[model samples]
Target: MWRAGLPGGLRAVFEGSPLSSGGSPRLLEGKVALVTAGTDGIGLGVAEALGVAGAQVFLSSRRAHNVQRAVETLRGRGLQVSGVTCHVGRAEDREKMVQAALDTFGAIDILVSNAAVNPHFGPILEADESTWDKVFRVNVTAAAMLVRLVVPHMEKRGGGAIVLMSSIAGYQPMRGLGPYGVSKAALLGLVGALSPELRRSRVRVNGVAPGLVRSRFSAALWEDEAVREQALKELGADRLGAPAEVAQAVLFLVSPLASFVAGQTLVVAGGAWSRL
Candidate 1:
């Protein structure tokens, strides 16, 4: 028997009781995420974060061994994960990567274009043609092409998130970085140009610019004591950044929590440059 009023004339209606215990909705449950060059470093970090958040993450790198190793490592952690060998600079490899994700996860809800190359470390003017081409091709062009391929699938799902990995060097070129910095600068522009068009299709495009992240890729910069000290002085952070920190920012950008965020580059450089 239920009463129509409670206590002193206040109406009380009890049609059905609410459930006392229910699982909180994960931000990315059942979602599919694809991350390029994800076998190690920041790419792998992003992949792990997405997988932990309940997304089936697909990762890839140039070497088959690395792909297998990463897949096994993530699987051992009980994350829904898979991988394949892919060189982002090659068209066939890129196609194969996309197909692999489709085959395993059905659809891609998040894309992290994190593959980049910095073959040369010298003045921009002295950079060889081959070095410039390689840097631009992998760092800038491949990212744009991957976005082109993934956007169609994202549209099919109504909307999705895309994160382009840039660098603090994009805003303030680091000494001796030359063409690599230029390529990163182009990524910032790429996000700006594509964000509006991507938004029309309900797909959000954003960028993450990290500064002096400690990884095998940037070992030359941070591993040297003198160089590390100078960088630290400029950055004002006593510690260099870890890949996980960058990965967290990428997770936020692609999550429902950042639904209103789009067409912007979030700098995860630990206060290296004010503009970045």
Candidate 2:
């Protein structure tokens, strides 16, 4: 029931038999995944990919309307997906999201911390303290808190996988996005810090740093023709990366495919100079 030729050209991966020709091997079957800020862009793409891989997905966003629309969109494609409105920066909303996932799926096997914000776009020193607080609170503090909240549930279920959404800028900070880049860079360190603590519980933690992905959330970068061309030139990529392309990397990290991959930040930067 997955739509023919999904946005990422994943038709073969989600249509027909669970093991369709060149399709996913039902890697996440019988598992449940929770994706934050999953109503649109990269989050939605990841949710759709996980659902296609056979996980009952629990998605969350800050807006009720966005949550409703995403649930309806994925459900229309025959995926077992539920959603809730959760502003990740708020402790109460985060609690509600985790409880909702447990109430709906009983157990948690995967967590994709994709929610992030970049309200300021200027020189790092030019950014205000309040902006920095908001950035770190939503992009780093909230993600770490969510991990703490879900680890127990994952431990009870035996073991689990966690993927933090980062950015190529985390490695090579982009111009006019210094604070955003720094916040993403923090996640790279977080994977290392949390992996050791969570390993005892069989929880594997990793991160994904995507480059110049096309999304409404990133329209400022890609919608401007000159900027898009320049960025693509720097990346040596013929075109902008799709949200689904980044989602696929996320899928690999959260599935058995990445069982031995932990405490590392995989940069999907299309040959962009991202070494740090």
Per-prediction TM-score: 0.89, 0.92
lDDT tens per residue, model 2, 1-276: 223224445554444444332366888999999999998889998898899889999999999999999999899878899999999999999999999999999999999999999999878899999999999999999999999999999999999999999998888868789899999999999998999999989999999999888788889988889999987786666677777778878988999989998899998877787877
Candidate 1: worst 10 consecutive residues by lDDT?
Answer: 12-21
> What is candidate 1's local distance difference test score?
0.84
Poorest lDDT segment (10 consecutive residues) of candidate 2: 1-10
- State the displacement of the C-alpha of residue 32, model 2, in Å, after optimal TM-score superposition: 0.6
| Candidate 1 per-residue lDDT over residues 1-276, each given as its tens digit | 111112222112112211001222356887899999998888888887788777899999999999999899888877899999998999889999999999998999999999999988777788899999899989999999999999999999999999999998888868889899889999999999999999988999999999888888999889899999887787665667778668878988999999999999999877777364
Decoy 2 TM-score against native: 0.92
